[model samples]
Target: MRPSTQIKPISLLKTQTAQVIRRVCEDREPLIITQNGEAKAVILDIQSYEDQQDTVALLKILALGSRQIAAGEVKPAGEVFERLRKLER
Candidate 1:
């Protein structure tokens, strides 16, 4: 499910720049800026942006893992566990 997006016209940003930014920071939701009735830019809070970046990085890692498995490059789980168990001895 997608988060609810707030849309505001470019004129609003031009007129109420600080208010818009304050609201975005407080809400932690993306604000879509539209130009001539078309979407153009998005305003996001710093924390949300960082979280999104982290999620994207994790997704990339998962995708790489999937590709490795598909290419028959995965180690056997039993063998890997046996090695770890030996290390614990």
Candidate 2:
């Protein structure tokens, strides 16, 4: 949670949608939208949202690699590189 300025009630959001959106985009910070005093939604700038998605996708790939290693479903790096080099020929 941030200061009161960064948090807006659903009513205010409806009335001041443009300003709220502008603030979030310019500040590069998420705006917390609340209903009944409970946080309900977030407004994130496009770049931050895309970056988060990219990071999550990378984490998924890393997790898959870890699981493969633990299950011994792996190949030798030398063999893999040799196959790549031959493919490049």
Question: What do the candidate models score in CA lDDT, each in turn?
Answer: 0.92, 0.91
- Model 1 Cα lDDT, one tens digit per residue, 14-63: 99999999999998989999999999999999999999999999999999
TM-score to native of every candidate shown:
0.80, 0.88
Candidate 2: Cα lDDT at 13: 82
lDDT of 2 at 69: 99
lDDT of 1: 0.92
Candidate 2: lDDT over CA atoms? Answer: 0.91
- The stretch of ten residues in a row with the least summed lDDT in candidate 2 is 1-10
Q: Which stretches of candidate 1 lie over 4 Å from their true place?
A: 1-5, 77-89
The alpha-carbon lDDT assigned to residue 6 of candidate 1 equals 91
User: Model 1 clash pairs?
Assistant: none
Q: Which residues of candidate 2, in runs, are more than 4 Å off?
A: 1-5
Among all windows of ten consecutive residues in candidate 1, which has the lowest summed lDDT? Answer: 1-10
Looking at model 2, residue 1 earns an lDDT score of 39
